[model samples]
Target: MLARMTGALRFSPAEIAGFAILAAVVFLVLPLALDTFRLNLAGKYLTYAFVAVGLVLCWGAGGILSLGQGVFFGLGGYCMAMFLKLEASTPAATRIQSTPGIPDFMDWNQLTALPWWWEPFHSLAFSLVAVVAVPVALAWIIGLAMFRRRVGGVYFAIITQSLAAILTILVIGQQGFTGGVNGITDLRTLLGWDIRTDAAKEILYFVNGALLFACLLLARFILKSKLGRVLVAMRDQEDRVRFSGYDVAQFKMFIFCAGAAFAGVGGAMFTLQVGFMSPTLVGIVPSIEMVIFCAVGGRLSILGAVYGTLLVNWAKTTFSESFPELWLLGLGALFIGVVMAFPNGLAGLYADHVEPRIRALLAWLGVRGAMPAPVAGGAAREMAPARSVAGGRQSGRSLQARGGASPEPGP
Candidate 1:
């Protein structure tokens, strides 16, 4: 019974504690600490967390480096934007424009009729579905073609980057249909409810945080599953995994599509929080920045990715506001610092330096005996004596009492 209970717990004690602390921080600490405006900013940062978490699965586990995730983000944001725009463009609301039933930008560009593509977005249901489906479908096609051909590594990254550049150009060049270089703006409401209110912003923050936690749980399950092991196996030893009766291409494609779906949901959330979507976010720079968020957070750790996104964006906002000219230099230095000092990111630093000290501190505080030792895969390990079990027998009772030097084995 004891062994079964121990084996049933998938996470180590430290990991479970870490997650509990994170939940408290997001759901309790931040709200109590910040004003409404500041909390809204945090909500905006959480939107990026969605993208960073997705990258953890695709790049960290599957070893697929896609430089165009912003494309999917933009797709989802645009989908949501279209719905808001249509809602705001009701004939009664647009009576002053030459085209009384269409978007203001279309009227400005001398477009008398709504574009065929824009027509579908008029339905809230279709728009909601498109927010996720469009990006996944695009990723599916791209993954199918590239993975089937065994195209990966730097070549795959370059192709994705090119796609991002092309999509940005197309959105900019198609003025009447895509709102030109300005992208989508002036989004008024969602489903007849004003999203610009302070109360709405506060509520949306919780919603975003809850959704992020849900995604983290889903990603955690995937990472602990057999398929996740297959992904890592393919990452380190693709030929061996392929020859072991596994369909390597299928796993790669599935992960890539899943990542796209995650990014799409994030983009929609960003549109809601920020009240706009733009071509600027769909270009090469934003996509690469998303990668940096994952890298700085420890790409393999989902929670770390969330923190990374928040920290980096918070730094960006702070420095850009106070020292505008120095913001770019500071950001570049951050990227360099993370890569040079802690290649595995903030999570890596915590695991390597901070966690051991924490354990020692807890032990000194007389709480160590109640906690399990750190997991085996971590950098350090501590052994503890076995305790009494059912029927008064010591757990793992062995040669220790029989005068042998060998200690009880650690889990």
Candidate 2:
């Protein structure tokens, strides 16, 4: 049992190397190369990566495509933003406002008392829990309604997109309660710590990186477990799995909720790093862009999501600065090119093209057992062992091991 558990939890050496390389790039290289401003921008990009990683598990692994992830992200950000805004809206701080101790927007909109729903956010603990719980709760409801009924594919995607649009309109319409079009801005501190400083931003960046790794590891564990296999099977053969007596709807709901939880956490971190949560980020456009991030990063690869987010955002910043009018067109073209030319995205490219060369080089260098079997998108493929015929390896081998050429054993 212990050995079985260990094997289940084990990661391939290539995955370990990937993790180390990513850590170095995020924690060491980027900080050394970029100034504080650029580093902060990268930090912001990392927050979106949270959503992309979730998409990998939900869309890539489970075949559940949600285009309304921004709703969860925005909810999480709003939870944190409410806390920060309240802390900044002390009676003394907002003394000049018509209603002291209330958010400026509330006071401007003639709200004399804090809304009952917003009251709970004043407690940091409650706010923290709400950041994740709120989104998951919403996901749970949606999953129950749709997944249980087997409403999925493009129809489900359209529903989620509609949710994003609805949420954006609700937030904008309820200005007094939600801070409206401007969002919950002017956020100053977090539990008495000023979050607007460069030093503070740097600290938050490292914290975000640490949290990202934690999420990645959690995702890895999920994908490596039996549950992960079930998800993949359900993705490829949902009716088969359902007919085999598994609770397909339950599994789908769980993974969807998990994705929402991850997105919520990202939204909270985004609020801290950017010091604001706006409707612009919680709308249809941003939601669609989030999907593009996952696709560009290799939706099947968790780590690739982070790299993709950084790459796309960096390109957006660079191109928009130069050709503001054509940036949208370029972005559309880039997405089209990626979808058409590289359906599996960067991770697929690396696995198909780059990993083999690296393995050959290691083999040439007489490195024995240093390079473990390669994984595609951080998950080990299910390969069959070579069959023995006449006391020798032959016949009945898997497609990956045809012609007596056995694939490398996975960890």
Candidate 3:
């Protein structure tokens, strides 16, 4: 039993407990506290949480800081938006348009027919598949090209940032097909069910939470696996990892693609919850903001990433609402503070200070299972031999001094 316990204890119980608590809060407490409108807003923020979680793995563990996650996010979002836009732009609904069967923005821009790129999105199944698939495929190409060529560090970041800028400019330039700066808006339904209703928002909120937790679990599983350790090893010592006969580039590629997938799914959820996908969200600023979410949460901690995203976004919304002009200044100060003070983020602070204090308090209060049980067999073996030897020595000294034979032990 003790051996089995030791084996099972290889996995960290503290991490599991943290995830369980996070699940409870996300699934129970928040839904109960926030109203429909606020919950829907939470769902929107949760979409960004998805991006943050991915960043935790890619940037924190894999040490790949992608400044173009918004591109993947936008691709996934636009795929979903295209499907929704098509459904919303049916002939009957667009009877007033010169192009009766096209999106409003396209019609307004003098497009007489739906573009070839927009046609595939008419199928809901294809749209759903493309949401994750498109972003992942793009990431695969980029990762393969960059990692194989040994392009990383600040250079890789700059390249990704440039990609984001280019994509944003393209979106804004191609107003007819891409919806320009206004973006794909006025999304109405999903499979004939109205997503604009309060009940739908409530349902979507729960669904978003479920998906977020699922992603969290997937991330945890990966992090606990051998591959996760390899990622960390690679991040810290890329040359050593490569010298150890491991295909380091493949590992980097896989993580990059995984991060892109997460961001893509998040973008789809964002479109569903918020009813819009815009070029504003598909640019360098939003990409950097996503990184900040992970940074603020503690990049190494997955649960911290989620909380960090929610906290930062909440602060952003509140500050923007209250003191619109000071919001940027406040954000700048926050970034500076996080960099200078909490380099490891909230998780590091909790792990270093709060968790140890909690354990001490629990111990003082005589709480059971405050920590995992110690491995018993080795300690017991060492102590038992010492006791036997000490007893023999003491008995020998006493018997010699007394000049009497020792009695046999009782059964």
Candidate 4:
């Protein structure tokens, strides 16, 4: 019944068209007007946009509140940074007797030579894969252990937070591989690509913008699919969804891995654009900010995620530059005000002005039969749910009830 009422404002194509064009305009025009410095700033916001989209899926769609994605983001960033740092070095610089051209901390500690473990990162491709695969595999194992036991909500948040804290401590203590407190620096190039060049900066800017759009498209596709509905089911009624027949743990694992992977992409984009990353980027403060971005954006909504990320980061950058001393106060007041009054987010502002006509267009297109099947969500999940185990806590109808048949099952 609640779903029915909300369906009154069913999604629309006209709205989607308008959004696509506006996004293209922003992507196209911004680089023209902005200086390289400002373009880089836009890149940073785009990275944050990726993070916010993941938060939307894990929080908005799945009902699993994660606070430690920053850790995953950093893992990917630091990993990529290591590779870039390696590539930036000359073969002569890496020689054993080579001037002890150690990382600065090593100079302080009298250490020498890049550690053996750091060597594989010399290959650009390897580093890129490590950045993505490492965090996702870790998230997969962690999600399996936790979600299978049905640990979620606050408990899930706590576990993720603990993971972030542990990672930070480990990185700071290792001193050798991680570069200790000062963190990795002096990274100047990537794969013979001169990062200092305006061309490089522009390319990186395009990478950030393109990835944000891709993630947005992916997020919207997932949300519109039947599997997406199942994920939502698992979010809204974990125990019941299980009893009805779905492998709840597997569904959770997939989204968890996906969210971590998205964070990794964001992290890589961040390191490449910003040219630095440290424990601070992955610490508790950032973990909190990730949640705040999701919350202010609208926990379960993609548009909400994009809006919140761009707006929050813009505010942070804008305020910090203009009034560095008042940055903290400004951020705090702004978040507090938004949470208190417009928790649903600026996406709501967009919807109010434009959604009705969009829905009407979708309905009209439906009548013409020229449109392909509505692909609001993207690629389908491969795993099949054990339907006998799926259902109970929710008042909403399951996909089982909707079609009396499953969409062709995934791998």
User: Best candidate, TM-score-wise?
Assistant: 2
Better of 1 and 3 by lDDT: 3
Residue-wise C-alpha lDDT for candidate 2, range 107-190, written one tens digit per residue? 999999999998998999999999999999999999999999999999999999999999999999999999999999999999
Candidate 3 lDDT for residue 118: 89
CA shift of 224, model 2, Å? 0.7
**Reference-based TM-score of each model:** 0.88, 0.91, 0.88, 0.80
Best-to-worst ranking by lDDT: 2, 3, 1, 4
lDDT of each: 0.83, 0.87, 0.83, 0.72
TM-score of 2: 0.91
Candidate 4 per-residue lDDT over residues 1-411, each given as its tens digit: 654455423445433654566486457777888888888887877787677788878876777778899988898888888887766556556445333444444545555666787888888888899888988988998998998888988999999999989888988898767877767777788877778678898898887778777887777677666667888777656666777898988888888888888889999888899887788888777877877777676665676676677678888887888999998787778678767865545554344344435546866777553222332211111111211123352224455454434445676
Cα-lDDT of candidate 2 = 0.87
Model 4 residue 265 CA deviation (Å) reads 0.7
On the 0 to 100 scale, the lDDT of residue 117 in model 2 is 91
Tens-place lDDT digits, model 3, residues 109-146: 99999999889999999999999999999999999899
- Tell me the tens digit of each residue's lDDT in model 1 across 271-371: 98888899999999999899989889877778888889989999899889999999878878888898787766877767667866777788899895445
